[model samples]
Target chain A: MITRTLFAGFGGQGVLLMGYVLSHGAMHKGLNVTYFPAYGAEMRGGTANCTVTLSEEKIASPVASNPDILVAMNFPSLLKFEPTVVKQGLVVLNSSLIEESPSRTDIDLLQVPTVELAREVGSERAGNMGHGGSSQGQGKVLRTQP
Target chain B: MPSEKMLMRGSNVVGEAAVRAGCRYYFGYPITPQNELPEYLSARMLDVGGTFIQGESEVASINMVLGASAAGGRVMTSSSSPGISLKQEGISYMAGMELPAVIINMMRGGPGLGNISASAADYYQATRGGGHGDYRTPVLAPAGCQELAELTFVAFDMADKYRSPVMLLGDGLMGQVMEPVIFPDFIDLKDLPKKDWILNGCEGREPRAIFSMLLGQGELYHHNLDLQKKYDQITAEEQRWETKNTDDADIIVVAYGTAARIAESAMNDLRAEGLAIGLFRPITLWPFPSTAFRELAQNGRKVAVFELCLGQMVEDVVLSVGERAEIYFYGVPGGVIPTPAEVADFLRSVAKGDGEVGRRIDV
Candidate 1:
């Protein structure tokens, strides 16, 4: 089985770190994994993202135009990648930051109050983990949090 | 005895390996994805009685390395894509003077004004002699943190042995990735072969001038020819590669550095699918392991070259095969890297003789 996920948000939102953690977990599970980040100016306050592919076999291109899971931590991320989610794919959005939800009928959209869940966890930066776990519950997306 | 293992970034691994190899001087400017190298060296060099300088610019850094090497000390400098471009002139001069120094390039995207993204776009410039003049620098490509450490030591050894500049070519991902690295046992610098050509004030000996300039055309031509001879010797002796499951394989995938690591994963996937696919990873980018590739191609196997840049190393692969076998290219440009699955897919098609041409995957 092959699972690909893209996490996108503002630079300091820990989107890249989320991807790193996910990739590391996948590798630890004995899956072949590749993680690539949007570097350069895109990392400086702009929309930053990372693409990770975890597979039982081998992963081909690390670039995923249509990801199996799209974790959007901000409004721009949701708007930019919402259209590229695979059919029946899961889209996890941070409800606190994204006022409008993706209305794509082909994909399952989960609107999670990620910031609130993170605050409940005693760490505001755990928003990505909150969204990641919530989306994993919806299906197909692997449980990435260790 | 086994070496000690340490959790290190690929860049710092290179720096540490250089120190272990008896490098006494380091000069570099800070660059993203590789800044940790000079930063780590700043402290480590002090322990070894070496010197580390954060230069004003990349040009100054390379020149400083050249000066230190000229003074009979093993020296090194490092930079990323744009910074490397600025140091090309000094590199050419170093090569001309036959100075022994190691230069590390944590490559990023580029033609002009490219950013801090991992890309092998500098392949042509690095392997084909980016610096001017009829000269060449031995380029070593390391796929992972382990190779990053080992190859750094090799780079220093090769520089001193050949009395020429050596380049350690890595990318942004390689620079930043954390891995367990085994540090080599310390070798006594005094035990290494002496460098008589270095200018050490020439006290009581005939004055030795170290310069690339030759006034006469014949002398210049002779110098270039001598350099070519050395390159030819290196090509014959120093080509390094790793071959996985090539025997009875139908498709041989050629890749180097980080791309080779992805290819290894992809090769495993193709093998599980009952397809005959093997991986050929070049550890020495310049010498290129052409002999092994030529032998593989002559065995009537199809070749597929994968790279992060458009058809750079593929051209060399084709030349190595010498039209004895059909070759294909799969490239991902603009700071993109193909996943192992994608590479497996390409390999499967090639093995089946599906005849699918090159394609790009946007992430």
Candidate 2:
């Protein structure tokens, strides 16, 4: 089975780093993988995103139009990519930053108040990590939120 | 010998591969999407006892490569779209002189300051002898990080074998993607064929001149005829391509570089659905693997040429297949890359065209 994920957020939100880490782990695991990041001015305080695809077979085309998982770190990213997720796929969002609920009804929505949770844990900038960890754990996004 | 696996970007791996291929000199200017190539070689070439120079411009850089090649030094240069345009004059001169050099074009969106995004728009420029005059250069397109490294070694060899420039054609995506690659043992330059024609201070013999300009009557014409003969030989011997389940298929899709990778996935998807689809990826863009296309056409196969540009390689496919096979084309120009699912769906829609005539040709 192939797993495609789209990680989107503002430029400074560690969006591309998350993709790199995921692809690095996939490569070490001997899985065929591809990580494509948006380049140029978009990486400087603008909307940025990356596509990461891991599969047992050789991956074709690094651009995923409908990813199985969507990691939206900001409201813009969520609004921009919400409609493109696969049916019954997972949408992991930082609830603290985005107040508008996703309009899609077919997919599973996981809301983590990552900023609020990061602040409570005293790091304040760990929202990206928090959301990433939540995206990996499919069923615990809501169950583990204390 | 076991090689050490290292994780690196495609651009850096290509640079390292050039060094391992016995490339002792590099000249290039900085350009986005491919800046890492020159940057990596700039610091590492000296470590390998090679020379690296960041030229003021692409023209100057390609000329430096020409000079290095004329001296019989294994040399390379790299640039992006606009930079490659600037190097065309130098490339024509190098071809005229019959010098050996490796040029890497990590193409970005083009047609004048286009954008810093991945694109295969330079297909025509790379394969059709972008430089002026009548000359042809062998070109290779690598699909992944490992292929990028592997083709760098092959590019150097092909250049030296033919006494002409060879191009390693890729896009920004191939340059930026990071993956694990294992480096093999460096080729021993001493063991390879020596450059007997190098003008290394011709002593104890008659004086030899290396000239790109021949103004005498029939001088350039005869030189061009010899070059044409050499090109014909290369076309016969150096055509490289890959086929997946093409032995028995109704629809054969022809693509190259990243587009080929995507087309492969699409073919797999369609195959699972009982569609008779196969993929043909050209590793050597020039020489074009036309023989493979001719064989497929002789076996009565239909073709669909998919590209990231506006149908460049499709022309070659049509010429090779001729009226014996029907041809179709789908292309997304500039930096927009079509998804595998999208391509698969498109292939599915046309999978049942058993008796349809050629869409691209009037016959």
In candidate 1 the C-alpha lDDT for residue A31 amounts to 65
Q: What is the DockQ score, from 0 to 1, of model 1?
A: 0.17
Chain A alone, model 2, TM-score? 0.88
> What are the per-residue Cα lDDT tens digits for candidate 1 across B142-211?
9877779889889998999999999999998888765556788777988766988878887899998899
State the lDDT of candidate 2 residue by residue for B1-363, as single tens digits.
Answer: 425776678899999999888998999999998989999998998798899999999999999999888888999999999999999999999999999999999888878998888888998888889999999989999998889989998999899999999999999888987767887678887876788888788688777788889999999899999999999999999999988889778989899988888888888878888888989899998989988778876566778888887778888887787888877777777787788887776576557554232235444
User: Model 2 - which docking category?
Assistant: medium
Q: Highest DockQ among the candidates is held by which one?
A: 2
Q: RMSD in angstroms, all models?
A: 4.7, 3.2
lDDT of 1 at A144: 40
